[model samples]
Target: MADRDTVHYDGPAGGWGSLRGITRIFGKELPAPGVLDTLAHQNKPGGFMCTSCAWTKPAHHNPLEFCENGAKATLWELTTRRCTPDFFAGHTLCELKGWSDHDLEQQGRLTHPLRYDRETDRYLPCSWEEAFAAIGDNLKRLDPQSAVFYTSGRASLETAYLYQLFARLYGTNNLPDSSNMCHETTSISLKKVIGASVGTSVFEDFSACDAIFFFGQNTGSNSPRFLHPLQEAVKRGCRIVAFNPVVEKGLVAMINPQSPTEMLTGHETPISSHYLQVKAGGDIAAIMGLCKHVLDREDEARARGESVLDHDFIARHTHDFEAFTDKIRATSWEEIEDNSGLTRDALREAGEVYVEAERVIGIYGMGLTQQVHGFDNVAMLVNLLLMKGNIGRDGTGISPVRGHSNVQGQRTVGISEKPELVPMDKLARLFGFSPPMEKGLNTVETCEGVLAGTVKAFIGLGGNFLRAIPEQEAVAEAWQRLELTVQIATKLNRSHLVPGRAAYLLPCLGRSEEDRQAGGPQTVTMEDTFSCIHGSVGRRKPASEHLLSEPAIVAGIAKAVLAPNPKLRWDDWVGDYGKVRDLIEATYPQEFRGFNERLFTPGGFYRGNSARERIWKTASGKAEFTVPKELSATGFEDRPGRYRLITLRSNDQFNTTIYGYSDRLRGIEGTRDVLLINPDDMARAGLAEGQVVALASDADDGRERRVGGLKVLPFDLPDGCLGGYYPELNPLIPLSHHDVQSKTPAAKAVPVRILTGAAASG
Candidate 1:
């Protein structure tokens, strides 16, 4: 078959109107009667801001910054499909479960508010007040910890802030958010090395960098808008070094559908100067190899009496480098060479790029963060950057390309389980309520806590929390124990499966839709990947008029649970979101400076963080570094029937939403069950490509998940590791297997084996 690594696409690359033409042809497109004009792209002369990927290329920061995925997000958000109650009345919950993701969303927009009817197995129309009262009653019945306050990346800062506060007022600190699942390890490790979990560089820095190192991130499909800046870097002679098992089109060179120059010439931008296909879960080894190469180059340079690194930056800004150097020197070159899955030649070339270039920026994504040794993998990258004095400088820093618009911003605004002394101490001082000092549950911890029946409720700001987790069956069962589960969502997906004793589906306005309350139309705030927070106002009507804004719902529940809350003013802010903004400004002063007035500005001002630039807010006010003896190698168990399986989202999907029908890069369409495996391993097991296989997870109890009837595509994966799409294969992952420090499911480190068997069901 055509060389296995080759990417093929039959779909027409019809720039902008591809979706519009399809909408006219097909009946299933928008949630309302017609498509709304709600893309985050600022095409209008001076219209509203984009609510898609946080990256803003407005003429101010403009270098033409829309990624492919960002375009898809904009297109999807501004759809014309509607799922009226009449549509649901015509179908059953059972039918909807069997429907494809595109089919479910394509049915139309949710025209009216819907509530799950247990007796009838159908979603019936329910008023916003009725849904709110039902949710309030459920919150009144349980302890706060049982209910998890989950947030999706698809929310505004205003909604996310209000949701987190309401959960705190209800006495629960189980804020298991989207960040806990993807880049918490990046935040954790970056905090130690650079004093911040966020990538230290801004988009403008890419323009000035001489070299860019991409580790484990497939940006083209995952975050397409980044291509413009990357293309510019290439045009200016900045070499791009990409390291990952899969060679993505976006990372390589796919003609930018939006670029007039590339489109006119029908030519693609050359994405990478050197593409290193490292084995899966070999990031630490790869990073350590790069470091060793740099040291070797330094040694050679010392012969000529010239230093290969920035000694002054290291001497003044860092601590314990002598010990770090000792460890680096003692590390065996053999381990680095073998474990990294890259040749010395490749690493040497990478090191040359670092040494030759005066300034370098390392841009990475979740592939670097979701490993068994995720934290250490991140630390190793930090160590590489530190060796060259990359932080706190112009045109050189670590830029972690975050997923979901503003996912990182949500964590900054108090969605984290790891409480800093500043926010925790301030919360007790300002609100006059004793905050829970015990470290609460994270993503996997929340799930395990629920399985043990400690957590009683779950309130999601947005996203498919159930489908997003690993081991779908066990997570689904754990969710069944909750006293109440509420999803404040724009569209429904797999999360509703966790039917609590009382489940409330509150329909809310999306970023593309307008949010109106008693205080007139209100705009919400969101932060981009660069940690820039700004406001978002929907240009279209609500998907359903019966829907309420997330803030109003949060306030409603706060009023219900904190009936006797003396200091907490819930209704006051509900009447006017500006009051909510005022409270946010008063509480977290780092952001929201003159909250309302700032929105009137063009794209809003960047809330500068000194801490983000290596200014540690830790106890000693210096970043701390710790290495888990058992990291990245955590899932490298030599079990007989087990292999490390990393769960990933496909280019066709965003977070847990299946936006498109296929992953064209992987040669699969109309299916998510295809597993990426090494050809040698498949042959060793006597398995052929396109084989239907049964996977029995060795979770002590021998949990057998029959996800059979699947194709086995041989890929450039490490011999002992396999890769698959998440949420669907989540059932194979045990809820107990998680990172000790982060409480995140080792989604990048799950171990499972394949067998020929029957189709698996959830």
Candidate 2:
């Protein structure tokens, strides 16, 4: 049975029309008529960044600032509901555990401060003054080093800038953010290959590309508003090659989300003339295949006395071409075909398209980052771009579609665990005192630290770290060890469930809600994927009058913790956060020039990272070649009945929250219980559509872990594989299991075994 609170519909999950099911982003029960005002702030006036995905959109004076998903994000944030401490009184930790994500949040916006009363098994309300004081008192209980501060992409640039400062000022460098969970690899790779970890292209880049390779991302669900650009690009004859295990309709739809003619008449813009389905972990091999095909064509051209390769660009702009070429030549055709889930014809077609295109763009999401060889997967694409001289030019570069709205922006304004993190270290030296020197934990490390008892306290600036993390049991164990858990968020989430022996749930303002103090109105900044820095403010009155903005919340905590009087007057910052901007200016030089003055300017500013020009800043000062791997994710190669299960968030989802039960594109609806399976695999297992089966972990060394049970159905999926919604399947993913180089959990690839009813009937 579905959790009692889940909204029920009578359709297949993915078949719902994009326009018909967008309301699922908010609780299906919430009321709304049409689009809401998106121009909530003036810090940038018409220069509003897309509030949805990291993908940029043209600044519009249009009233609908919110996309379908963006509306969900807004409505969910601005709901009239409130989940106060008294509400917690009715629900115990045990009771809440059985509640679905929607039910937990639908309980209402939390108004008063909340503290988990273990004796009562409920989180009773605590006052803000008491909550702040109690949190400080709890911090006084542990060594500052033992406390870990976690941040989410939901935080504003100002809040994050102040957050790192407070952690250092209070004496600890433990800052692990949502970045660790998603794109830690992109940050590590970009910072190493390029001088900075930001993208080179702007929104105009999409317009410039003759060929765009979209890997591991579904634009329709993730960036619905930005789909118009691709629609235009396709109309301009741009060739789009989509490489994902499950072919998303967004990549092939002949309709555009923004076009009224298309919307009124259901016309989708055609895309992905070539759809190559690569095995979950076979991205590197597929890239190698492309390289082989392109290089071989170059050889054929040379024999015919014709030019095929861009020899001049490769010689002057890049290095180690010979070694890279040798590796591609040495790779065997059979190996390539078997490793990648692609055929020679498909690979050849893709290579031909790339070779013909003048400007090429490679766009990827968690698909490229959430693998054991995820880093190698990206480097191959970068190598391909470099081979064709497709970088540093308009519309020609690698763009990693970020998960959260300002995930990359948070890093731009300085929230990082990078050991030699330049932003924080520079601020530390400029201000005073030594910043924490030890390499901080990424999301994976944070989980281990929690379980091992090395970490005792957790302070979150939005984001549900606990529920969002892989391995439910491991996360559950580490969470219980926290001496104090402080979550600064707008609504209830699973991270709040990780009650510290003493926990504090401090409600904060949402991006859609107005935030004002004695200083009139204030706006915070965010960084888009294009390295553009801009500002935003709230319009709808906050869900609750008691809510505090993230900056004010952080400032209040600092006041309570930095006792007796610290150098920075926390009170003054609370009084006027412009002073917070002053501190951010001092903390970050260069880009934020005349921080206060420039901010008042119409278009805020971009903290320029020019290496986005392909000026590799690595120790070698050249783009490094990451060696591809041969090992598939575990439990697959050596055992029968074991299969690879990749977890995904459906259309009505963003990270941890599930907005709707239906997935409009995949043709699923009214239920999230069905697992997507290849017809071949379904036949092999004798599983028919809607037959209930269990998804068990291959992680059982002594004890088995069951992620969830779902009805199997034949869907558009690759052979030898199955798929389902995530966090629900996250339990099967162990914390110990992650991409070694980047601490990102392999959410896209997990080794699992399918079982029939009653454990093993087959």
For model 2, how does the per-residue alpha-carbon lDDT over 1-762 read when each residue is reduced to its tens digit? 112222222222122355566544444535332224543332235333444566543454234434567666666665666787667777788878888886787766778778788898888877788888888888887898788888988787778888887887777767888888888877766665555676666677887889998888877678765566777799999999988887676776645444577667655556788888887777877888888889988888899998667778777666778888888888887888887777988899999998888899988888888876666767787878878777678879888888787888777665776646646566666556666666666778778888789889899998878788887787687688788899898778877876889888898877756678777777766777776666665666666677888888898887788755445666677667678778777766677767666543443455766655566677777665444555242223635777777787777777787776767666666777667777777878888777888887786455567744587767666666678887788887877667767777877878788888788333
Residue-by-residue lDDT tens digits, candidate 1, 580-687:
778678777866668777764554557765644667655546543333353244455556657767676776677766766567655566678777777777878777
Q: How do the predictions measure up, each by TM-score? A: 0.91, 0.93
How does candidate 1 score on lDDT?
A: 0.68
Q: Which runs of model 1 end up more than 4 angstroms from their true locations?
A: 1-37, 40-52, 57-67, 421-432, 564-569, 600-603, 611-614, 618-634, 638-642, 698-701, 757-762
Runs in model 2 lying further than 4 Å from the true structure: 1-16, 23-35, 38-51, 60-65, 564-566, 597-604, 631-638, 700-703, 760-762
Please state the error at residue 528 of candidate 2 in Å.
0.9
lDDT of the candidates, in the order given: 0.68, 0.72
Please give the distance, in angstroms, between residue 359's alpha carbon in candidate 1 and its true position after superposition.
1.1
